[model samples]
Target chain A: MYTRTLFIDGQEDYPLTNRKEVARLAGVSEATVSRVLNGIGPMKDSTKKRVLDAAKQLNYELNAVASSFARGRSGNLGVVMPHVPKVHLFSTYYFSELLSGIGEAVRSKGYGLLLLFRDPAAEFDYVSLYRTQRVDACLILGASAIDSEIAGIHRLAEASLPFCVMDQRFEHSGLSIVAADHEQGSYDAVRHLIDGGCTRIGFLNGSPQYSNSQDRHEGYLRALAEAGIEPDESIFYEGNYSRTSGRRAAEAVYRDLGRLDAIFVGNDRMAIGLMQALREKGCRLPDDLKIVAYDDSDAASFTEPPLTTVKVPFYDMGRLAADKLLARLTDKDQTDGVINEKLQTELKIRKSSGN
Target chain B: MYTRTLFIDGQEDYPLTNRKEVARLAGVSEATVSRVLNGIGPMKDSTKKRVLDAAKQLNYELNAVASSFARGRSGNLGVVMPHVPKVHLFSTYYFSELLSGIGEAVRSKGYGLLLLFRDPAAEFDYVSLYRTQRVDACLILGASAIDSEIAGIHRLAEASLPFCVMDQRFEHSGLSIVAADHEQGSYDAVRHLIDGGCTRIGFLNGSPQYSNSQDRHEGYLRALAEAGIEPDESIFYEGNYSRTSGRRAAEAVYRDLGRLDAIFVGNDRMAIGLMQALREKGCRLPDDLKIVAYDDSDAASFTEPPLTTVKVPFYDMGRLAADKLLARLTDKDQTDGVINEKLQTELKIRKSSGN
Candidate 1:
């Protein structure tokens, strides 16, 4: 019961060092010392006064230490992430690059990285983390554009806390966001396929809950319209941005392959899976079908015939988000303004795109 | 006991001030309060009820984080590792597997894991982490047997702090160590090669600084001696555990190809480099030169001729190390001794070893 504030274990607050000594000096049991030192609860005034006087005399770094993390700084940068069991999230190139970037910047400031995993579907209070936890600043990863998530982020914004969200977009919410230009990336990738004389292109994107996916969808549509090609909603597919999901979409894509000559995938994992599944279905790479993928993960180059991928600057995005949030924390002159940073993405044209 | 519904703080769930308040109300020691509240470690029923009643009385928010370390420690487990630029450590099979295990264990304990990267050659103070920072316990990964590292670990042991070293040996130092049975694995791998009717076997080893490498050397020599085949030191080669280093050994290995039929490599990375270089030199795998390597990394199976390798239980070692160190922190009566746990390893038979 080290001062339970709105925050859990008061996230950053350290309990008093030697409670036994203070209890003995106050002529009270350690429990009583604890109750009285809280400066609240059902403790009698005399007991509270005695404990306070003893604590003052002992001065066990209590005044400067207690509630410092909750109200002040705890020297930790909290990174909020989705808790997916058994998936070693960092093993993924996207997470590995992003985390390494955050680690580099956090190291420069000599700050500890506190990773907090929450079930994105569960009811978690994001605002309380800022109000009571020891985390001086926080950066949220993989935020979705869902109502519950938006409301949660809204609370954090309303409180005027120092935080930044990576990838996900909350337009006009005044929240700090660092992301790659996925819309432009997808547009460029699809245009390349069009330029290569591929008139019929299929778009496979992730869940619409992610703003990036929605942005990618818009880009895909824009590119097709600009080419004066009629939209083929029947050939457009949606995945969960997982390799398995991409594999699942292969059946649908295969059925419509006669009409579709090329496919643009949301991320490299999905592209790899799609390619693998397509190969199993006896489809020839770049001959019968051409492909383009996003994210450009390490596996992109290893895939058969390789992958023409859009390289999102996830590392730079993570670094920029952390840097801006950190500047808000340590830099007093830093004023309040919506920090909307959109880093550029590059195209890595490999053999898969028939280039 | 008050109802938990009446939260005096608007945002925070519970109306509790501190666990000391709950302890005072329960008329018990703070440590007893911690043990009962955690519901994780061993505790008496009477103590549990008392702590529960106290919590109910104060409307305290009962959580693992709030009261688990009421003794004033930062609720972080610092993971110290060597920092190499642009390497993306977590992307590697060894680091990714080990870290995932550590992450799983840490989550189960409701503690934050803090990653601290140190330049191996630069002077670093491990003791300051426990003394100044909030980290209650620590675990070191990829520690080498150097004077500086040993002295650094010695200081932590001298302080009698809760710490564990993963996959390293500090013989007779009484430091807690969790490592895989590399020597036995090497023995088994070599025996496999001998059982394949290879009379003249070459050995490609990593740097001897690591105790595991030394163990592998011993295992290799023992297997040869057991086979009554005179050990040939001239054909034995060493690398610095880099793919380039393994490639560097290919020239010497190629020159001795006429004298040797099989080779036992220290790790998959080196084995891969050797295989790639040997292949470039027009050496056919298994048919021309049988090979056995250690550490069945992700790339092990992806090689042109998949490697026959030893699978070290790095994940299990990491999980066990974290679990043991975490227990020592929460368990008051837990006594310390030389904790040396050696997990087993398995040999995977693939195309590279004439299997």
Candidate 2:
């Protein structure tokens, strides 16, 4: 079904400037030349070698950009992240793990990764990436359900773009999401603290803008309700999931230290900070105030008392997001519905939780 | 100067299938159309608006891939990192900080970041990235001076490609290198320990394959010589820059704890591990084992006793590498000679060094 462009050897009407010239010299069909050059379909070794040799003789370099445009594929996957000034996203265990997973998957598939950062406060056109044909598919990370963020998600969904949000969720049914069950993870951690003879337990949470943080908060309340323990607002502290914030939260909770027996922290970064701050204040871990945190990051095992935490499997979530997006890109017909994959989180019992 | 393809209305000889058609319809020179469409060079707003409006009227969507091929610039930078299975490179504080700097610089330049990973143990051609015209420039990260790795560096140098090695030094003068002064940083750390009344201090270093490790080891020896103390090889432990290795090193030194008054760790990851392991064994920090570590990472300040460490400006190094590469790409004539920039490191005195 390919149209052959005639390139007569001595005719002035036809110029020897296209793939047809290579095909003619190689004594192969134009389709074979296209397939061999693009590495798209299966081809015999002899035929492929002949086509390559012909192109080499003509010194015909393949224009990858032209070929990509003709094939309607960019061979690149886009990863959009939030850009916060002075805050190095890579320094955080959360983002680095997700990116590693995405990078691994994209590399294995022979695709390039195009990383772009979007300022959360600035107005941006996320769909312009696909409209400009810069990426075949996209994966969004660190997205909150803010007005602009949610609008961007809806735009992607309406455009029918192949994308998956890593560790972020929304109310839209058409959106694809890959995240850990933070609520259940949080519940399990709190329940573990209660089972360890802990009453009047405090909870340190991140910002409520993130769905995971909201879910974790809900889980904390649910676990407390189940144990017939009345929740006290005074013992709950809100942090921004940063070490600095964790230290500040520890300071805030120190006033009520006499009333608290245990505490559940949002993430390992904050947990590590809290532990250090409490230690500096002469509070003994597991003896004065036991602690349970989430995202059993690398720092968790090496913390002072080896933190007990919820292993959120961030790397797996990243891999699964890329896999799902790639699967959709490869098989559009079969993978039409919105796929929401929530990986399970395991509670690792370490010494810090009085285990 | 621009070539204008001839076309006749209602003539079967000419096909309206190229950028020439868009140029002709825009009533502007082909150069202006090319410049406006590619977003290159300054242009009058009225002229740009006219050209864009004309393109829209003609239903012409700019094929960026084809345009990139025609212009001979991809507007992308390639970042090649080492790929280790099951090991997330981003989870480490070292890489994340470097990447954050690189990302910030790359974004400010309006260029896309193309990330790729190469297996350290495998033989691969690094020049293929430039040969394929996939990136305008390249940056090599996490590279050691192994035979193949060194050969790849030479290949890029010989090819005269605009590239820089982040935090890796080579014997060749033709290479562009950006790294921290690890030797001086290590010397300062050890000297600080000695000044703090430490007589017999241990050294826990990473693998010798990395140049930083070798520099750190030299600094350790130099500091001991300056202090008029004989170096004891028996107290030296080799690690792989991991917390697990640090923990093991601590275990090995536990038997000789009575003989040692202080320890110098290569990086914070290993130092944190060492402290945790020693603390588990009933050794009090500072009082029992005064420790000095490298890389004042976020975890360092939040460690149990708030580790005292040498601050290697990884973010600044990354930014400098990117900035150097970008400068060469922009002004090749002025930036011809190889540039080697070594940023100074500072010792952050905290509680861990008994300060």
Candidate 3:
């Protein structure tokens, strides 16, 4: 009720200042401010000028949120992530990093971050984080989590909240995305290894469910095929980008260790773990077996022999996503269907790859 | 009136499933369901049992948010991040890492993430994000963009929202924080270098204005003092936690190459830059000069010879801060002032430090 009376008469927007406050500041009557705003029986044009000028100087954005609230449309961002067990928690740095970028992007444009972690709740109750008037937008990361909560998210989207996905390309969905050129990065990493005299190379792949993982795996396989080296199934092992998984992959290679001279890991986390396992097994880097990794994470430089890795353009992806979201929020008619941009990755050649 | 009737009947905590739906499910009349909820018009206990059973089967948490909206409070986490220029707009790692921990912690407890970036809007105007009525708590990351905006945050805190700062300890009134044990991390880095045949160690520090940076510097000095080695003022260079600063610090060391045997960099970003500069200047890890860094970031392990750095418990800090915030939210009587927990940092030894 108070907010209604505070609105400027005949104005579609909220008042820059309440009548009582404006009257006190400009030494004018509340009735006069109302008359000036409504254009009803205005005194002098100069007096009206005084009130209008004061409102302009206040620089109010006209309580768009309040009006939205009245319409049951809350402007917020719903971030849904997998609530994995503790051992698998830190292993999901990719999720964390991407969310951070998304959070930064949306918040800069004056939106909110609504985080949802899926756990074992009663059927259909888990995805309720997006059901209420909490977020106006959603950024879903990784496809597996989306699968589990697709129904709930669909309900939210139907309620007019814009939703997007990162790092994955869905065939049927119209969700926007900002992803790295993981395939190119993988290609470059393998090529670097080949150029450095690595004849027999091994591949440690991430989970096949994630599209990015699949893309990286394809790149690795293609690079091997193009180089006229028959892809070795024994040389390939699937990992989930965790240190333990990387270590296991290394152990799998060590079980039949004579032929491989280099290894290409799916991510830096697993690469570090693989390197650690290799070091423990008395293998020297670049001398016995060289290593290359994707994601060029902070831990890559701290491995026993620094790894050669591909650097994801996280910073650029983050900024681009934010800019895109801001552009979407500001322009109503700009529903240019899901703009998919792939930023380039840099191949950082370190000592592990014999560079 | 419906909510009021439910409250009068002591069924306010029960969620809103239409009486008709309950009746249809329970094979009862709408009046019977209402009588069961209201406890006024006589209804059999069996009928009440059926209605209560139906409500439980629906798996609903009473929409406390809708009620809170009526009371003018939004239950959301207000996250504050500095908008750093010349850097990737999105902090792929920072947000990903922090939110993974925080998102998991706040997931079931029902507080959503309310991310707000500190835009360069004359500092005072940055607080306008809170005017949207979407945030109930605040999570402030340590950075400069939001440094000048703390006053606005303070104003937000006064408006009855809880705020928490991470990776920083501010002396500001009414601020709660969870900071890393940078001092311990620095101590470990310097001690490791000393143990590795380094008598003259150089320090590449972050900005002194940052409380964490200052703590690290003090720790470096303390380690030197403990070893009866007077710190060489010329060897200590102030740098931002960036690669450019690392390169600058490396250059300074290279100008007087023989004076220093080891260098300790502040963060992994700068450490990579410093290592690049050292490598360019024909410096070999542990052979020409030993290197140790703080934060033990993903990129650190991938440097030329790999870095030996101290690990900052960043993820742990995020979890602890969230737990603290949640504890406060659940029990208002848990106000025991700022609970300062200094998580331990491990010194990860690698080839760069002659490991």
Q: For this target, which candidate reaches the highest DockQ against the unseen true structure?
A: 2
For candidate 1, write residues A12-80 as lDDT tens digits.
433444677888888999767644543212345577678778866876423212334323455678887
Q: DockQ each candidate and list the results.
A: 0.16, 0.31, 0.19
lDDT over C-alpha atoms for residue A294 of model 3: 86
Q: Give lDDT tens digits, candidate 2, residues A1-355.
A: 1111111111122222467888999999876775566443235658878998998898674544445544556778989888888889988989998998898888787678888877676434555566555678889999997887887788788777778888878887788899899999999999999998888999999988899999999899999999999999989999999888998988887888899999999999888888888888999887989999999888787677889999988888898888778878778584677878999999999999987
TM-score leader: 2
* Global fold similarity of model 2 (TM-score): 0.85
Model 1 chain A is weakest, by summed lDDT over 10 consecutive residues, at A61-70
| Model 1 spans > 4 angstroms off | A1-71, A250-260, A278-288, B1-70, B190-204, B222-265, B270-293, B299-308, B335-338, B351-355
- Minimum summed lDDT over a 10-residue window in model 1 chain B is located at B1-10
Worst 10 residues of 3 chain B by lDDT: B1-10
- Candidate 2 Cα deviation (angstroms), residue B337: 3.7
lDDT-based ranking, best first? 2, 1, 3
**Residue B292, model 3: Cα distance from true site in angstroms:** 4.2
